[model samples]
Target: MNSPDIKPPGAEPAVKTHDNRRRWWTLLAVSAAQLLVVLDGTIVNIALPSAQTALGMSDASRQWAITAYALALGGLLLIGGRVSSALGHRRTFIIGLVGFAASSALGGAAVNPGMLFGARALQGVFAAALAPAGLSLLTTTFTEPRERGRAFSVFAAVGAAGSALGLVAGGLLTEYTSWRWCLYINVPIALFAVGGTALVPADRPIRGGGRLDVAGALLSAAGFGAVVYAFNEAEPLGWGSPKVLALLVGGVLLLAAFAAVEVRAPSPLLPMRVLSHRARAGALVSITLMFVAMFGFYLFMSYYTQTVLGYSPVQAGLTLIINALAALLGSTLIAGRLHGRVPPAMLILPGLIAAAAGMLILTRLTPQTTDVLPLYLVPALVLTGLGLGCVLPPTAGLATSDVHPYDIGAASAAYNASQQLGAALGTALLNTIATSAAASHLASARHATPTGASVHGYTTALTVGFGILLAAACVTAPLILKQQRS
Candidate 1:
């Protein structure tokens, strides 16, 4: 029989001497790593137009720039998570940062579209490694409940604000400098983070005794990759295309297989225990829904600003500052205060409702309308930000709260995987819906005018986006509230 005092097969050993100062420094390093990962998603978005022009990319290939990163990051996230458990978070984190910075430099200097896409994929691969490792590091670093709460609050705030910050930073870099700067920016950040990591103490190293869930990893990655690819192709190809149908079917089968593998494996890639708690499951669902609305909003708003409102890259970036600022304020003040006092569900419900309302308001924007005319959107943006701030902290807190210390890496992996999948699905689905709506509107436009068709399409897309957010709210409300009541 196993010794009762012995650590689990793959668990990290506890630190001999816990130093609070060193831990905080470690948190900074981890936070910096996370910011780099999240920021890459939107930062490149702001540079898409410039990259296209510079590389002379065809319209057909433009989406690949974004899709490549999402597919790689989303596909490999579970693998990254398991790797953290099999290896150690510190080793994985440093490795990821180094790889990501190198990839960023490659993308920045690329002269062709293919090279750029390759670099983006490389970046995603490393991001998948870095993101989960960062979260896992946070989970292990703060063992005390009070300290954990404070640590998560800061982490959640950064997650909420990172995208908007990316937009502003991307805009500034792309406008004043070159689009290459967007990719190049990670170099310095990663270097600074690496330096901090050196000063921070490493977690108790894992003994190499357990095997990787290779079968599970392949199935989950491929399954998710296929689903995302199907959605992406659905826009360019009709829904009935055989390729899309086959991929969709294959993806479903693979995911089912992954579930089967998890059940029988000696050490599951995703342990069932990580998701045993009602509050944790509810939090994951809430986060997924929130991203559905948030991702769609960003995609549409970026297009509207550039194509419809005639804003330059810099102006487009500045417009998002309002949302970022509000997110920072809300997360810092409201989210932190509400934790442990009110049920997390109570905070999540109103937040989802507010976001849905904001999306509803945005649906009314027209091509001819000035940004000032839709000033109502500012408050709505704040509402969306506020809602996100409330949901993220408590949800993150709850998800990892009950996890076994040995499985903290897996828990972090699961959380980050859900987030990436949500973003991918949200972006793909919303883009498809918007594209379809645009085509339909164009076909039925007043005098077949380009501007008129574009306006009608954008409005229709926004309307559909609002409906999606409402549906997300409906799903989140019950699960979270039920858990809260129980």
Candidate 2:
């Protein structure tokens, strides 16, 4: 005789409701973590000069403050993604938030340069963990089509605005408080976010008890690290240096090995299945290209505002409000409307073209240029923002679209990894191009007038920025548009 059929009460249904509520809270917590991490990259830029004078850093060592974070974050992002999948998003997210906050505190309190740099690198490692986990949490939390689109729009907008907000926040904090506050600010934010994380649901691990692809992780990390190092070296060591050549070759070989290993591994770190769809591939490429152009624009435009136009950090930061506001509008309004109305590929093509046009307009800046009113620079800034806004949301949505639910973490990780690498490469390559152009311009002008040559050099750099933007547009056009008909 069967024991009375066990009803188990209504506990199962209750548990599911509780879990759903927790998942929504988790998305908020994760998004907060992501915003902090992304903002740190640019916030430091505004405070760099102040930090430099206070810390007595040399010109060459200055870039390391930024590069240290990028190198570690970009290099380890894929590993972080895979690790999150293997462990659990909830666990990884918590660990990352705690680690990131601790590092930020350390960096803020540093009395010496070495400590600060080390802290930044540590922050990068945790950021690598936090970013993908945050994204994957969103991907899993919102499974319905409309809810997914809304969720991604909010995520994308936060990400797009993060850099601009960093500039403004950095200026205020640096001027009123200290450069260290920029780092210290993360502590409280992270703490609050961590508390919120407790409310989010934890996802179960992929079946087969996911294994770490040690070889794949190493190969991918080392390869990206090598390539980034090569780009950084190119500016000081020359493009043809033996060390540069060695690094390029080593990076290529390691990446080739990573591809091979991914093909063979039963539980791959980044599976090929995530990239099988044409729309997804197009979206990833478009996102990469958008960052490529936008990062370079930021690098040059910041310099143009401060060094060339003689604006203080606060003034320059304020000017960027135009771009920031435009981006916010584009992400929220334009991006939301275009979601199902037009395919992502079509949206990306025009978005990139507009960004390229903005870059071209900026190339006209000169030493005597004082106002953005007559020169079309304000509109250019707005266009840049609009283009970025259009590209980021849809591209982000498409990148993780069509993947199996179990693979969301890995897919999100891959998307974030590509973005980080793209930004780093874009920064390094564009800086090198601008620096070389500046040197050439200065060399020619030195014979004519020594004092004026510095300004001439800056103009030359901005010109090169224009060319890079154009090239980015050309590269992305085919990739984005070719998939439209298919």
Candidate maximizing lDDT: 1
lDDT for predicted candidate 2 compared with the true structure: 0.78
Report the C-alpha lDDT of model 1 over 1-486, residue by residue, as the tens digit.
Answer: 978888775454344344777788888998889889999989998899999999999998998988899889888887888887667889999999999999999999999999999999999999988988888888888877666766777788788888988998998998889999999999999999999998677876455426888898889899988887876776678568899899899999998899889888887888777777777887888788788778877776677778777787677777777777777766668777766677777777777777777777776666556764257568667877887777777778777776766677777877887787777767767777777777787787666666656666666666766676677667767766776787
Model 1: ten consecutive residues of lowest lDDT: 9-18
lDDT of residue 309 for candidate 2: 68
Each candidate: how many clashes?
Answer: 0, 0
TM-score for candidate 1: 0.89
Per-candidate TM-scores read 0.89, 0.88
Where model 2 places Cα greater than 4 Å from the true spot, the runs are: 1-27, 52-62, 235-238, 368-370, 445-486
Indicate the residue-level lDDT of 244 in model 1: 86
